[model samples]
Target: MKRVIYGLFNRLRFKHKLFLSYLLVIFIPIMVLGVYSYKQSEQMLNMQAIQGIEKNVDTISESIDGSVERYNHTIQSIVYNKTFQKIVTNDYLDLVNLSYDLKEYLTPYLNMMVMLDKEIDQVTFYTQTYVPEYGDSVLSAARVENEQWYKDAMNKTGSQWFFEDGLFVVSKFPRFFADKATNLVYMRVNDDSLFKNVTDLAKDYSVAIADEQGRVIYSNQSASKNTLDADALIRMNEGALMVGGAESFLVKKAVRQTGWTIYCIVPAVQVSPNVGSIINATLIIIGACMLGVLIIIWIFSKTMIRRIYSLNVWMKRVEIGDLRMRIRSDSKDEIGELTNRFGTMLIRLNELIDELYRNKIVQKEAEFKALQWQMNPHFLYNTLSFINWKALKSEAYDISHIVTTLSKFYRTGLNRGDNIIPVRDELEHIKSYIEIIQIMKDYSFDVTYEIDEAVFDYTTINFILQPLAENAIKHGINRKTTGRGMLRIKAKLGDRTVEFTVEDNGEGMPPETAKTIMQNQCSGYGLKNVNERLQLRFGSDYSIAVESIAGSCTLMKIIIPQNIQS
Candidate 1:
């Protein structure tokens, strides 16, 4: 099965693979976190409901205890009063005497007790010596003794509660007055008034007051058939309560003044309302967010993977040597940068291909041109050498030197039909041409050379220097009035270029004529062709400049890039 799944995965396309990867990386964790968050939210809601129930039960217990305390305090006052003790224990002379004592002591005391606690409906005393007549706030001993509460009160030591037909709080008289009065003080408290505040405090839930045996004494709602496990409810105090197989939150706080437990019962449905709403809302929000994220991933992956596809196609074209293919994208992300780089590479590759083709054609043309000049210069050198040998045999030494210099000049100028020659060889050609020119005249300009030895090894186009020297001699020095002038030839190396200057201290042309000569606007074929050839071999960066002052001096400066020919 695993191999089958792996085989299916291996066959998937790149786009599908990316989409599946995004689904796993993005959505899986979100789903896990969504489920975890819902559970935590439910637990938190249940905890808050339990806390709320405990708080309500505590509030009810405090109210009931406070009311019971007030009643007990009134009973304490009656038990300690000397006048009440005398009314119970002293022998009365007759009915008139008893009425006088009752009006004076019991009447005022009972009225004050009633004023102290509004929940007390009536106050009655039971004893062996005194039998109080039934009245508004009093009860007869014979009428209460027939009841079970009266017998229960007789056996008790301290304060006790009886909530059978009405809420009664009974307490024995103080031990200091025990011998004089075997009496029990009881208050028939108003049960509805006692529990009204407790019922209001827990209006959201059904609250029940229960005895130690878990009998339901009072409840704010109608009793249901749901029987509570009394011992379990007590043992699980402030915990869960099971009612008819359903779980509920119960807060059973014991009222310390009474043996009663205030039970606040909250059904499971009520406890889960907030949790249900939160889960529903959270699921809706998570579903929407997941949908939005998936949509964004789809668009993003589509855009990115589309670029990769285009790149792959263009690469395949390039693999086939088709450099014209281009991928264009406007996005500034990494993929866009990749597309731009690919396009740039193709463009540069095309340019290089065209340049190589043009260079091949130029090399062929140069070879043809060199072939045309090869025989002419060699034939001219041989003829000039023969003439020099004849001139030397006839004892014409000066004429022989002229022919020798001429031969050397033509030989070096052709440079074995090579376009680039060493700077020293070009300088030697210049000197030979200068010597021949001097021999042609009776008096010639003195030529001096200032050439750096390091630049002698650098190469430039053959015959570049000879033409400039000839230009200075023919145009400026030869036209001088005195016919005797100075020609200075200088060559030097700069950081990236070589410079040669031929300056003549002879008749100079006007600045406009000099500009026109440099601009190829004048009748100067040697200078024009020299400039054109240097530009054609190297690029437009190599050039010639003419600086001249009328009738004073003319300087021709040629600058070319210095390089060693391989």
Candidate 2:
């Protein structure tokens, strides 16, 4: 019962495990693919948001740029003003009076220019040497020194306004401002008011502007505040272009003119709803398909289990040796096909077993007849000599002993010319042969006898023991040169019949030769004939075997089955 259950478990279907594993296998890949695809979608969405922010920043930067451009135009007007003729030529000292003239000329772009004329926090500028009313109070700043604008622009007669390095957008040892410059008729224009926003873009964003020294000159926020990284201004001046992150942005260039990098990050939960819904739908569909497949497998496995149980029950009889049994199968599925084949194999195996049975009988008969013959001729010769020895011992001696032994021997040896005999009768024949051999050889082939007396009532092939006795006399006698040897024969009742040995201490043959003499046809007469006859009556499984060594002794084992004789 345990064995049948084991076979069923071993035959489970491969596709079933594949279907179940895919439940997890399917989800694992979906999670991976969903994450990858979601990342791509997130990248596109973030790119779109950042692009919108960039457009706004570009607009604002362009507006700052327009203010700078207008400042350049306004400064051009100041340079070409007829009021500045004395500031341009050798009469340049007359520019002390030209300050009032220059004030009107600076009017249009003047709001920041006047503020620049007043000294302010952390700012600087340069003008002509003749307009030295602001004094040479130009001291090397703690942060900026030896500025070229102060040294070189002081030698010029031109009048203009511009910014210079203190702490503004761009910085170097030589401070250069971004807008206008002062002239000989002017004092320095160093103020925080030089730059202004001309357009109202970037309301949704923080905005600021810086002068040449990288300090925020103007901003939408509180003073001393900077919307772009101070480090980004350095990176920009070093020509790295714009920079941004979750924190800051520097709109350096774009729109063929202005651009920037800015993150317009929204909360993650807002985007997750749309993307999560798609993934949820996919998982639900996969789960539904898996559930449907599991249902089918459950139903099919039950049916398959039934078929396999039927097969197992049919096979139980075969394993237990009922070769004639077979499973009846009509279905064309795999289970049915297996059953059909199993039945066919059972039929062929049974035929082989039956044939072995018939062959066993024929073989045992031939071996018995030979063993019977082996005893008869040897007994006849020994008996004839025994009678002669008595005739010579005394002419009047009674012949009864010789005649009685001869009659029993020949009667047991030849059973109305049939190969079968009673176990009792065959044992009697063996005694006669043994008695006669002892008379001639004058050596006791010491014999021991044991039998289950009930076995004596069963039939056996005739002359079963005599050939074994003969083998003992011829081969076993010479095996041990120094001692008179032993021979024993026994029969016992068993599930079958158990018969046993006649052994002798004589010149025993080698084990190979002993087996060969008992087995092969080439050994002629006694041994070979006896073996063939026994196998004919019983089976190849029942036979005679000899055990020996060269200088020791030999034991001849004869196994016969009372229930199996012909």
Candidate 3:
């Protein structure tokens, strides 16, 4: 049965499998939780709704207090206004000037108040003056003295809020000039603007603002009186109240800034409607969230699958010795770093392969040369004898010296076709080349050798010393025409390396000329060739150092790693 199920699963497409997994992992849990929550939350819906409504009412109460406090702050700004106070009490001005200048000075203050508070429908200042009216916002004290708002404002000590004609009147008397002139500033709030934030809460509910005396100040429903069941209100707690009808639920909040109460009279059936809607909304949101997650997962999985497919293709190529292949990845993730490391490893592997192939070819060539050397010994000796006889017959001793030195040079340099030879054989090869050079130049310089016998048994690259000694002669000694040049060669055994130096007491080279030997920019092929072969044998760690001072001496030092042979 397990095998049958596995075969069926394998036959499904990738996208189908993914969608089915999402349904099980994501959709099923959400549906279960939604059903359970709907059943459990239905019973407590009414209580929670009442609590939410109470919180909203409390927020509305806070907004009302903030509006009242802002109005009070505005009134205080005017009362403490230095310019207004000075202008009102200024006796230096004539009556006409005082009236005109006071209205002109109050222009900016009135415009500022209108700009700051959009709820302020009109602002007015009334003073004890004979002028009946200056504008809609300025008035004479006598015209307003009989009005109830003015009487109410005067009866109180400081700022007060009064409602009239569906508007809120916040009035204050400026105490700075109130002794000589009864100056009053009134900020009127439009009724619709006052309750703008709570408009949605009042849509299906009857909302009212009631004063301390049970008189309604404002109501969203015109027919509903501000009067609630007085006994029910007295018996209720701070957050809730029960009306007489079973279908009604009331929540009230008291304004701390003013002795007023805000109430919401919602039908009990409204709470059940919201419960069903909330469950449906939650299910829809869960479905939408799952869809978004599926889309993102699908996109990322496809991207990763493509990268994996590309890497697999390259790996197959590498299995067949095709090391030139690479994966294309522009990302900085761990996979991209892995791709880069693989590329570097392939490069190193290719280098090692080439080195092994070349070494095989060199081994074959050395074996062929050894066979040729075994066959040519008598022939080589006869040729050198014939050359020496002709030179002695012509009475040319230099020609005899050249032939003899050349024969010895080739015999030591061959070294039975081996690439690594002992230090003693390398020194013999250098000595033979120097002897031929001395005979060629008629002995213009003297060559001395200072070799450590302990290092004579150590192995070194064949023919390495001859080039360096030849360089010291050609570039260092040969450049001096007047003085008798001196060539000194030294060999020493170091800690883990062998050191060889060639010094010449002749006209030395410039620093720039000495650098060109290693840079391969000079015409001195001998020094450059020796440096290259030394580095190839023992990495870049072994090299040649050329040091010289103009018109003094030149030194060429060669350093190589010591490899002891059995």
Q: Give the best candidate by lDDT.
A: 1
| Minimal lDDT window, size 10, model 3 | 222-231
Window of ten residues with lowest summed lDDT in model 2: 167-176
**lDDT of candidate 2 over 1-566, digit per residue (tens):** 99997686567666655445555555566567645665566556545655665576666556545543444444445445554433332144465555554455433234465455443232222233333322222222322325554444355433223344332221112213632333322233233343333124444444555434454444554212334554555345311122233333233432121122221222233323476665675567556766766676566546777788878887887888777775568999888899899889889888998899787776666654665566556567677667757765776344545555666677667776676667778778888888767656664557667766787777876666887787777767744568667776777777766666677777777767876776456443477766766776677898887788788777778777755434
- The stretch of ten residues in a row with the least summed lDDT in candidate 1 is 221-230
Writing each residue's lDDT as its tens digit, candidate 3 over 1-566 gives 99999999899988767766765676677667767766776667767887777777877788888877777787778767776554444433466766666667777678877887788788776767444465766677787788887887787766777766655555555554345566777677776777776565566666777766566677775215434554444355543344554466667788786677777777666776665586786678677867876786676547767777777778889998788765456779987877777788888888898799679557645654664476576688789989999999999997897998988988888776777888888889989999988988898899999999888768898877887787788877988877798999999989888999889987888889888767664453366666766776677788889999989999989888887764
Q: Could you arrange the candidates by lDDT from highest to lowest?
A: 1, 3, 2
Model 1 C-alpha lDDT per residue in residues 1-566, reported as the tens digit of each score: 99999999999987787778887788877888888878788778789878878877888899999988877777777767876665555456677777777887688878886796687788877665654563643444566787877887778777888877778888876555346546777778888898889778877786778775566677775223355445545565556766657777776788998899877778887887765698897799689878988897787768766778878988988998787775677989999898898898788889999799679658754764665475677578778888888998899998887887777777777766677788888899989988878877764668888989988778887767777887888888888887578999999988788999999997898988887885663453378777767777777777788899998999989898879755
Where is model 3 more than 4 Å wrong at Cα? 1-38, 43-55, 58-70, 86-93, 106-122, 126-158, 166-182, 212-214, 222-246, 254-259, 274-566
**What TM-score, over all chains together, does every model reach?**
0.41, 0.37, 0.41
Off by over 4 Å in 1: 1-35, 91-97, 130-142, 177-181, 222-247, 274-276, 280-566
Each candidate's number of clashing pairs is 0, 43, 0
Q: What is candidate 1's local distance difference test score? A: 0.77
Model-by-model lDDT, in order?
0.77, 0.55, 0.74
- Candidate 2 Cα errors over 4 Å, as ranges: 1-328, 332-349, 352-360, 363-400, 442-455, 492-496, 509-517, 522-525, 532-536, 539-541, 561-566
**Candidate 2 or 1, higher lDDT:** 1
C-alpha root-mean-square deviation, each candidate = 31.6, 33.9, 19.7
